[model samples]
Target: MSFTLAIVGRPNVGKSTLFNRLVGKRLALVDDQPGVTRDLREGDARLGDLRFTVIDTAGLEEVTDESLQGRMRRLTERAVDMADICLFLVDARTGITPTDEMFAEILRKRADHVILGANKAEGRAGESGVLDAYALGLGEPLRLSAEHGEGMDELYHILRPVADEFSERAEADAPETDLDVSDDAPEDFTPSAKRPLQVAVIGRPNAGKSTLINTILGEDRLLTGPEAGITRDAISVSLNWLGTPTRIFDTAGMRKKARVTDKLEKLSVSDGLRAVRFAEVVVVLLDAAIPFEQQDLRIADFAETEGRAVVVAVNKWDLEEDKQDKLKALRTGFEKLLPQLRGAPLVTVSAITGKGLDRLHDAVLRAHEVWNRRISTARLNQWLGAMVEAHPPPAPGGKRIKLRYATQAKTRPPGFVFMCSHPEDLPASYTRYLVNGLRDHFDMPGTPIRVFMRSQNDKNPFKGRKKAPPSKLRKHLQGRKAD
Candidate 1:
């Protein structure tokens, strides 16, 4: 269910007013001030049968600096990234400002998933702005007056198909229960209490990697401080982390490859990479002040690329002055940048104060569980049927890529095997769609999903398609020979 909608426009375009109408409540603060909404506010919105999450973000501005307007602009961009669709509103009363044209260009270049709307188009006065909207090349803008709720039916009509598409995905995720999945595919993983879940914590230097591990362990076992790159080896610590037996590895600070001239630092970084490869779950910790730096994205992407379950933790969150805005920005940034870890858990924590430690612990456990999850072959094939029906395999070069069956080959970073015709001809996009489907259906969020396609090796000529029946004369000849 990925039907998220973000209402974005210039100040007083009636975004918050329309947000109030959709949610059927005055949830957001409405003021004459342009930047009344500095923080992104989300509420359950309804339009006809479609129920979705609608984000009311700060108005879009031309500024691109450290000023309040600039920050709001950046946050709005992130909120747009977080949404599946954006309802780009423009003031019809003003009749399309030059800023509106600029914003339209930006939305076109960056966010193609936009539904244009001309707010305050309740009568002939709004008709001019509505026609002017056509020049924006964002399709016919929905004429509306958010103040009086004039064009909600049109809004519902536009949102209905989006709602149905997401509904189809939700239906694919929830299958019939009468499916007996025991013998078709054996369970890939069986949880063992004796075995400790292998977890590795990796990040840039001075990101509180050591301190975070110590906080989880409930002791200052590893070294911590202001100094960068203190730990030189991949240190392993055994502890019952919140009733779950876990063997956590405290990895050294992974500096950028260009800066790694020191021989010891190279060895330390290499050792940390090894920890990530061996670990079942990887926690990419980031210093809240400098979260999602180039190195941080690389580290997080590395873990995911290595097929390990990943959890992103924003450390030192206690230092943030405005928690709500920062969190909204951080999560939006997370989804925007690390899309491979789209549904992965992101926890904000303070290692020094032990704040959000419980949330971190819970996220780790949930990640591990998802990592080792196994789906039966019977259910998998059923899911495959639904997925192919919902989004058929792409036919390239006038030949169809037929996906025959699906089975779980391995778990602990769950991998699936698909028996299909012309496996090599399958497009990467379709494969990604199925992987995403598996994640959405089986509740395996943020864990790396692997799909391997193999050609069907059936030897029988009539293996799949029906063979024509033998003639009666041929049958009589065979009977005579037998007599």
Candidate 2:
């Protein structure tokens, strides 16, 4: 059971700054503008021996009305409530403002435990403001500057205890169950033998999805241009990235149905959708100026609905006037609009300039890792047992659904084969329950997840030896008769 920690504070206080630092990647959108962050983003956080789930929440806004701002605020509060520990950040450079205090009071009321962090506390200038953070009544503020990589040791100190406490509770509360899956375990469990993670780079016309692919390959392999929809076919390229061989699909740009009047464009769009279906990881690229269109959200939702891992790449980040603010705004928009990929990856880069390419690859790998993740049969069956105990599989025709066992059948898309009494009779909702369980038990959120139900007695059709050919059998019979 991974522990969850949420970072909450007023806008532009470097909440995302801290999140990127902890996750060891520029996953969250960061900018200098206020209210840029709109949605809550979660990442697998590692600090020394501390491994926990960290959520980067939108900056707290004081809006109570039923407007868009108010809805955004409500969503941020929900994120804080979901967290096991909230890292409440205050700007040491800006001092404790009214909004900071308001957010603190809100977290104190909602979060079970709050860890105070006075961000931007690097030089002598931030000293006075760090002192002001104590007035929030949260405890001694942990002084650190997220942008400069300052005071990380202090963060570890704060995180270790919470992680340990949660780990202990989870262990103690774990239920014992008798569901078994040893018979279905794969003969080869080697990571090398697992299929390469399938990744799709998709975006609107001229969003530079092809450029990014070419850059990743370090060659002029993928066709690129300023024109829209040049690539008609979804091209797959297999390569090794940091020792991990990944199969990347460069897809056609997805355009709106009304705008897609040409037959070629329609075929291209269908090809892109097919790539999405086959992919385990999907990277949605955006032109920095025209980010977050309805079509982009639709493509992202398609990936989420299919259980594929998703990442957002803001192409042409170098050309943007307010780079930081734009990235933050993009992330906020994604979280608010697409909750299906709640904790998806968002990376800023310039495909032409090659800025942030390394970070992009790192993000893809992390997303792939989550996409390929599989939990041990023991853990999954244990979780399944608890889930069944809480709400037993619903019975149709007065016969209860009997799930005999569960085992991971394949990797790339993180597929599972569940042995049941009657696979065809299992309801769609029951399968969803198991899929949700797999997502929760394993730290695989926002990745495409797959579940396949199979009958217990199902066997391979190609097993037994073949008899002799008719002509050979006839000759053998003739010889036997002669003898």
Top candidate when judged by TM-score against the true structure: 1
lDDT of 1 by residue, 1-483 (tens): 748999999987899899889999765656565555555667789887788989887788889977656766887888787788999999988998989999889888777489999999987888888898999999988988899989899988988887888789899998678866465655433234556788899999989988888888886556555667766657667788778778888888898899999666676688789888989889999999988999999999999899998999999998999999999999899989998998999999998899998998889888988887878999999989999998888878889888999899988779999999899999888888998888898998899988899999868877788777889999999999999
**Candidate 2 structure quality by residue, lDDT tens digits, 384-441:** 7788888777788988778877888777568888888777888887777777777776
Q: What is the lDDT of candidate 1?
A: 0.85
TM-score of each: 0.56, 0.46
lDDT of each: 0.85, 0.78
Task: Give residue 164's error in model 1 in angstroms.
Answer: 73
Please list the Cα RMSD from the true structure of every candidate, rounded to 1 decimal place: 24.8, 21.4
Model 2 regions more than 4 Å off: 1-198, 219-223, 236-247, 274-280, 304-308, 321-325, 388-410, 416-434, 451-483
Residues forming the 10-long window of minimal summed lDDT in candidate 2: 185-194
